[model samples]
Target: MTATPRPSESGLPIEPVYGPDALDGWDPDEKLGEPGSYPFTRGVYPSMYTGRPWTMRQYAGFGTAVESNARYKQLIANGTMGLSVAFDLPTQMGHDSDAPIAHGEVGKVGVAIDSIDDMRVLFDGIPLDQVSTSMTINAPGALLLLLYQLVGEEQGVPAEKLTGTIQNDVLKEYIARGTYIFPPKPSLRLIADIFKYCKAEIPKWNTISISGYHMAEAGASPAQEIAFTLADGIEYVRTAVAAGMDVDDFAPRLSFFFVARTTILEEVAKFRAARRIWARVMREEFGAENPKSLMLRFHTQTAGVQLTAQQPEVNLVRVAVQGLAAVLGGTQSLHTNSFDEAIALPTDKSARLALRTQQVLAYETDVTATVDPFAGSYVVEKMTDDVEAAALELMAKVEEMGGAVDAIERGFQKGEIERSAYRIAQETDSGERVVVGVNRYTIDVEEPYEPLRVDPAIEAQQAARLAELRADRDQAAVDAALAALKKAAEGADNVLHPMRDALKARATVGEVCNALREVWGTYVPTDAF
Candidate 1:
């Protein structure tokens, strides 16, 4: 006798086998449209990997600007096509390194950037015109983007030549990440301003990478990830339209970020379902005519929360599986987490190994030769339909509650994700769910491995650098620019213009944020549980 089959992470029933019967009424042409066409379920580009492999962007940032800059240069030398930056907690929260709250945390999680000086050093030898950069920032995304533009200008690179993305999805922060500064109202306004600013100034730049990665890390199922993320995308579109922007003007540049787990089949289905749903929404609901506006382009990062600390080396296999899932799911860019990530910052050796994993996938594997390899597979099509239905149901609930922002204020998304996370924990504790090195193939005693440790002295060094900047810079100019920023924030003007001027005048990240914090108070979440 065989045991009962377990359900998938999204609670979809898994059968012993799948055949043509699984897709009884599925139409290949309608559901699985050709790549780069409307309802882009197969892949975004028609040629997919046939033309070129996905951008290998390993997320790397640690210590001071000088330290992180070296890592980037090394990555470029190793044939990395794009750069993804990870900012420290202080920088993410819009605080300077010298702030009281940012003392011990400086340069611990990622790199510390206090001002334009730090930004310049961060991209020292990197040619802004030649490389694409992605900054994993949220609350202060506009500020960071402005700093990058300033750096590019100093390097003689035109703003129009700068191409990259800023993770400007602050709604997810209120739900999961907790890097949010101002309340939802001001946050949405900032995002709208970014859409407008980037559309006019940096035409090639991706305005916002509306992200579901954080929600997944917080324990959302694949279905929940798609539903909430797409709902957020809807809210952003509505906000931009209300802000007097055309759908085609900014929608083409809007991108998404997701997490790829070891569940290969389900992940591929999730990506397909997400694309189909988004295309329908853009075409039928919003009436967008531009093909690019309807495309659901996204970046995928391997699930960091799934990495095991017990047997660190086993994480390499985990990352490889996760990376493969992302590729199969048709991600535009990918960042493979290092094996040592669960313990601490990745060492140079471990980081290289992580990049090598992508190299092997792009070069050695036959997975890239075909577009949407799982297109006609019975199980995949059925899974895609199932995921889409589940996600649409969740999205309907969100719509009934007004939209993503309203649902977020009521803690709907957060509550649902927390419940799913609790279920996962319960399953793991009961041994119903097996994690290779963590629960099932457990080792009694793990091998000792040295992980990368950030230097605590870097905090003091960053503080000293800030002090030097303050001493040498023109305080009056910084004050005037900040006052202009405050005026713009209080009024209807695009705050990024003055914010850029403020950073150009040597204003610290904390100062710029505090100026806005004064105008629009910080967010304080209400307990829903």
Candidate 2:
């Protein structure tokens, strides 16, 4: 009896073996250019990790700002190179802790940041000038960014000195994450405003990390991920350009975020293809002349959806593999998911272990010595070509549908991703795909594990803090600033300017967002089959 060969997560057939024949017509000069050059398939930088290892950025935040701040300090102490903040539902949705809708979920998944005071406490002892922070907040990204800037100025860190990224990719929110606030047109206006604001104010900051991580988490294949993400990137560039900004002015600051799955070879190829595609799009399509604008620098997070709760301890191995893939794929930075993530929010120890995973890969392994280790591998090169071709096909479809926003409106990306997710679920359920500990390995009894639990009292405490903030803050100033913000949103002015003033005047997140909501209104998705 012969054994059946398995397929990749993208449904690509896995051959028994691949050799030089696999890439018969492949040209190294054209397909695999020198690192840091145009069509950057091999890697983005010339030295890659040889100069310095990818920034070990760990994603963390839970409970109150003080608690989350403790975690950040611990991560920094444990040698994390950067901070990636995860905001709770209320904060992500632009709600204050005291809002009726924010009840019972003040700080369950991440820190609840209602006002500048919460942002202040979140980075209490951490110096804003020194640490690079990545905040995973959409819909109200500009609001959170202004709060960060406010906190930085309070700490005497100039705007130019503050370096970080905001996952301000709202298109993905509509397609997968479902945290969108306004309709597409208004949402895009806000994003364009962010680009204009950042180019002038925070030159060192990565204005937007156009993300495909959430789409992948929602079950997009590697090709689909790159295609949809790049399409969204195209939309953003167009929006900025149409708003009278040169492509090079803000394109250099654009970054990307993606998932690093356990499928090492394909994940590597996906990253390579993404860079190549983005490089061409920027240079050929948009006529961007800056080398930075052509480079597709991205941060990678190990796939959380791949982790299994059935045998949670096995997730450590899974994370190690995913982290390795991200490193080998030449990520600019990385965030390794904690092993216990499948069960609950990562405890302090688990978070440390996750950071240690990246440390081990960086310091303990020789993989960092070379740039593009698999540059000449026949299989990898072929996979890169295959993935790029497939992604381009998907991108062309999106183009025909009038780009990402139009395609999204027509339910193209969402429907495609849903089909992919359904296929994967079917494969897993039918045992056609073996998820080691999930489906194949049987366990009668599970080991004892004490997961970190958020305190229920956090809600009341946050509400009290908000009450005090409202009592002590200059209400007149907040009202005036918010009025200006609403006026800006209603007109052609960049809203971030007035939005910053509103935040500086101690306006709450909900108040600022509500002011804009009054002008731009909210999004109501139309059903599309």
Candidate 3:
């Protein structure tokens, strides 16, 4: 007899052969009506990629604004459809590049932006109205968005005309990522304020990219990633409605971020199921009337965690497969990870290769010719239902714990993810899971690879920039604006309006965040939450 088929990544057993009987009781009218319609199980858009390929947004930035600006220009020249900014640790954590906590980490992970001066340089020659930008930032997302708006206004572009997204989901920070700034209560308030501010000012902008990408990188199973992410999305919607905003008003602007792994089938199923869940939740639970509010439009990034330092060049193949999975899953936009990422920051050549991978998929493959190519396939449809049920069970548990915030405070999500991570690690070590070049297809004395590295001197250069900014700006204006910001944060006023004034006065990001911290305090994780 043949050996039993292995389980999928979400721990669902894969049947050796999937026939029509696999979906015997499935109802096409109820489960999936049509592409771009209710539930959105097939795809969010009717034409899907047949109309046009998804935006090939390449995420890049490191060292300083000047360096990152050069890279952005290069990416645009090389056919990147959109820009995705990656901020350094300091900027992500609401600290200036020169802060003591920011010491050596100044510009190591991503680009350093301390104030509007840097923000202006980051988009120096780039036209804000023409290009779509997605900033991978949270906590201080408001600060960066304000800075971009100021730059756009200076370039004669109105806030209404600017289009882009900010990864403003801070709840995920409490669940997986450690870049949190304020405590949960105040953090939720800030997010609600952002939703209202964007609706009134930057109506075209996606206010928050409620993300599960980080959780997946941190080793969450596909089901856990979708479940925890949707839970966070629901929490954000509730907070906005509680803050006196209509569900349809802010919900339409909401977007999501997920990771695409090399497991193509499971990844596709995960995305389809996630859209159905979000749509049902919006209509049934939240009473969202707008169709846009029900659509789970998302941006997908290929799995960086899956890339290996051993035989790093092989990551190119892995990335291609992952990107294909995302495209097949019908992502609205995608970011393909550079092959060289596991070693260090991607070299310019590797970054171009990542974008080219998407181009090849879009033009050279027939996957873009149809909407939901896997629809009606026995295996895919069955797996989609299985993943959907598994995710709903997890979401129900989250609701039982009084929603995402309550579950986070109880460390429920984090604990579950860690256990999943541990299992993966154990499987890999036991050779039960094959990771090519690491456990299988091993090679001794791998070829020498020189990865791109940040200049340590860049930190000192940023410190100098901060010093010059301080000496040139009017201290009184900054102090006054920051005081107003503090007053707004302490009370019921929208913090972004006054916060914008502070940045307009050339106030440093760290300074504005510090002012808020004094009023709101910071988050300290106690045991995994």
Error of 2 at 512 (Å): 0.5
Q: For model 3, how does the per-residue alpha-carbon lDDT over 225-289 read when each residue is reduced to its tens digit? A: 99999999999999999999999999889999999999999999999999999999999999998
| Model 3 stretches with alpha carbons more than 4 Å out | 1-3
- Please provide, for model 2 over 1-529, each residue's C-alpha lDDT reduced to its tens digit, 9 standing for 90 to 100: 6556557777676566788899898888988789989799878889999999998887788989999999889877866658899999998888888899999888999999999999999999899998989999999999999899999999998998999999999999989998888899999999999998888998898989999999999999999999999999999999999999999999999999999999999999999999999999999999999999999999999999999888788999999999999999999999999999889999878987897899899999999999989888887888888889889999999999999999999989999998999999998999987898778986988888899899999999999998999999989999999999998898999999999999988899999989988998888887554
lDDT of 3: 0.94
Question: Considering lDDT, which of the candidate structures 1 and 2 is the better prediction for this target?
Answer: 1
Which TM-score value belongs to model 2?
0.97
What C-alpha lDDT values do all the predictions have? 0.93, 0.91, 0.94
Model 3: how far residue 22 lies from native, Å: 1.3
Q: What is the lDDT of residue 179 in candidate 3?
A: 93
Model 3: how far residue 311 lies from native, Å? 0.9
Candidate 2 clashes between residue pairs 3 or more apart in a chain or in different chains: none
**In model 1, which runs have C-alpha deviations exceeding 4 angstroms?**
1-5
- TM-scores of all models? 0.98, 0.97, 0.98
